[model samples]
Target: MLIGDVARHSGVSTRMLRHYDALGLVRPTGRTVGGYREYSAEDVRRIFHVESLRSLGLTLKQIGRALEDPDFTPSALVGDLIRWTEERLEREQELLERLRAVDASAPTGWQDVLRIVELMQGLDSTSAARRQQAVLTRPEGVPVPAELLAAAVLAESDPLVAGALRWALARSGGDGVAALTAGARSEDVDVRRRAVLAIAGTAEAPGAAAVLADALGDPDPTVRGHAALASGRRGVTAAVPVLVGMVVEGSHDVEAAEILGTLSQDPGCAERILAALTGELAAPTADSATRIRLTQALVELSGDTGREALRRLARDDDRAVALVASAFVAVLDERSPEVPGAEVP
Candidate 1:
């Protein structure tokens, strides 16, 4: 196939094909006497794989290395991509914190100001954690500011806050399980939240299951959502039932749907949860946001099932419910998976 045919077959633009060729990432199988690129069927396959890895955030260099080495594993590549993503997230968090600080300094209503202040404080804590991660992971020999880092760690007990601190410590080659577990059980809601979130990031911890289970029933939906997400992260089979139950009976449908979505990432749990949702059981909640999330989760589980459910829900007379349902239908339709082994959207 010529360059145009190759581009059409691979769904990559001609410009990108040239760029890949230039980088020696995906060279053409042959060249015509006229000097045009000619790609083999095998070349098309390689291009598609390259696109998939690029979509997963692999840099061109990383992709080249992986492609060049027969022993390179997809899991190893994904791990590297995840590390890059975390670094980007940390930088974005820093920029967000700086923006929040400016907003806090501006004149505003007392309530708004207070909220901004709280947000700024949280951002500061998150940035501190990111910095700690950098210090631990990067090869640059700059020493971390221990006193400042300690103060950042001790500032407040928000689940995200505590989780970040614990994550930083762990990344920095320290095991602070005792302190993290203590924080998880603290009387302070923030501290407990942090503990739950932090433990979720680790592979397995002794008391994490109990702590997360306790958090599942927290009065605050924020706490409940974090706990439920953490439980899903732990990948405990017991959590699947509890998370599904929350979807059915919890007042906060949005959070419950999020937990359910997390659980549905497991194939068995996904099938069971979809059956429960599409069954004759009463709709979990009438809230549009909740319904939208549930519909999306179902779609993720099985597009046809999710599409049918959304169509049924869209028939409701409630304007908000119908609107969100329609949106869900549109999203699924656009991204619907191919029936006979082709990509959906």
Candidate 2:
């Protein structure tokens, strides 16, 4: 087959066939009577082989070695190809994410696009300080996209940098709540924890309350506790049980108890919370430490219901419980404005 005929049959351009011939990659096995290159069936088959390997992202030089080197094996070359393809895919994914963020921002011009790109670079910087400054210091009146901030917050392992990212998302006025909610559902525990913290800062934002409510059931205790405390502060009665549990378990018990006390201020909730605390104090398994925490929480509550619970706890069976409860009771009886700390165990 002549070069032109070979090009037509194989769909490889004649110019490319000549280049391949010049490089001895697929040299024709014959010459036509007119002194032009002529390909035999075997040469055409080799040409097909070269094109097949090229489809796998092999460089032309690598393809040359693969086709001609007798001892060359595909194992190492294939491994390298896989790694290179994966790295390219990762870079493309990052670029796609940046483009989506910039599009979400609705940039007005090239300058806006440049600024957004610069901020994204800063957020992805290895230095924690740069990431933090990226979130904190955007151009005047050029709001950072909430989606970008949400992504940064979820990936940031550094506490200080993560706080800044969360704060920026919070101030975006719920624009990124959906993104943060996605993070909350991530399989990664750290990502979920960061999402919950970011959502807590925006507890007043639309849909943030529901996210926090859902997070109350998270498997991680820290995520659940943070969600519970934030929810309780927002007056969600569903958080009461979790907060009480925290007090009992001694994890962030102080904050949990204080929030519980606040939840008790509702006229309808007041009785329920007081009963939960007092019931724990009276449980048979209640130890000195548990009773003391319960008593301390009671002081944070208001109205006659709290005073009455403290009055009953003042006569508890345990001497330590009785002592702490009596002290709180005396403060309640005197109607003093302030309550002192509970004595050590």
Candidate 3:
């Protein structure tokens, strides 16, 4: 057959066939009397083999070497190809993680309305009500149909979607803590963060503390921060040690300070939080915001010590920290002084 006939039969382009021929990778058997290239059925079969190797991610050079060796083991080539595929998959997964982080940083819009609507239908009526509130409040305006929302919330079983819906509900003043807790186990980091936030907001939910505790160790700093905040907001004293550890050890020091401030409202958590900020914990550089939060937490946990710390921090180089400390001290001064015999102030 001619080059065109061989190209069509083997599903290889004519240009590629010429290139392979030039490389001696899969040359035609012979030339016709007219000096035209001639390809036999055997050549077509070899072309198919080359296409298969290319599909398996082998370079043209590697495929040529394999094709040259008649005694080559197909099993060995397939094993190497499997390893290559796994590496590609791992790289793709990493890219996907980075993309997800980027996406979360941006604003949500109508482009995901259909997908969100579809996912929302898998929830119950109460859950759907919460999602509706969130959708209506969305900056993009409500473009999703009511039926689609109801159906998607009712039909889908995906934990990620469920977690998002439950989070929307909690944000809308609905009690979806049960749903959020259920979604905390999802492989999706965003879902877990949303679940942690929801559970933290709902004070009455059972097992919410445990879920938030587990989330403190999440690989993603964003998730860990949210988890820390949830633990603090819920006033889970058991999480004090963890929250203090985060303030001292976490990479996101700003978030850690915020969580520490929240946790410091509990008098029992005072010592741990103070230790985190005082250089005893040896956390990396303490920024103005972190120092401010630490001072605020100390005030909430221990009035005298916190006031003293605030007085000292008021002399800090960072104007923002000094300003906050000054403001807190002024507020404390404006309040009536406690008399020795006065009722509990």
Taking the tens digit of each residue's C-alpha lDDT, what string does model 1 give over 1-345? Answer: 998988877788999999999999989999999999999888888898899878888888888888898887888668777898999999998767555444534534556454444434444544656544433443333222222233345454444544555555455333444446666666777656655556566535555577677767766655666666667655654555555555555444555566666666677777777777665234644465545445545555433545566676677566676677777767766786424542221
Query: Against the true structure, what is each candidate's TM-score?
Result: 0.43, 0.91, 0.43
Please, what are the lDDT tens digits per residue for candidate 2 over residues 1-345?
A: 899999999999999999998887889998978899989899999999999999999988999998888999999999999999999999999889899988988889989999999999998899999988887887776767788888888899999998877777777644777888999999999999999988888888889899999999998998998899889999999998788878888889999888877887788898888888877877889789987988888888856567766766777777787788788777776785433453322
Reference-based lDDT, residue 292, model 3: 57
Better of 2 and 3 by lDDT: 2
Give the least accurate 10-residue stretch of model 2, judged by summed lDDT.
336-345
- What is the C-alpha lDDT profile of model 3 across 1-345, one tens digit per residue? 999988777788999999999999888999999988999889888999989878889999889888887887778778888998999999898556444433432426645644443333333334645544454455343233322332233333555554554444444333345545555667876656555655666545666677778877777665666676667666666556556555444445555556566666666676666765565312456665555556655555445445656666677677887788777767765663533452221
lDDT of 3: 0.61
Stretches of candidate 3 above 4 Å error? 1-164, 167-183, 201-203, 241-266, 280-284, 300-302, 315-324, 336-345
Clash tally, candidates in order: 5, 0, 13
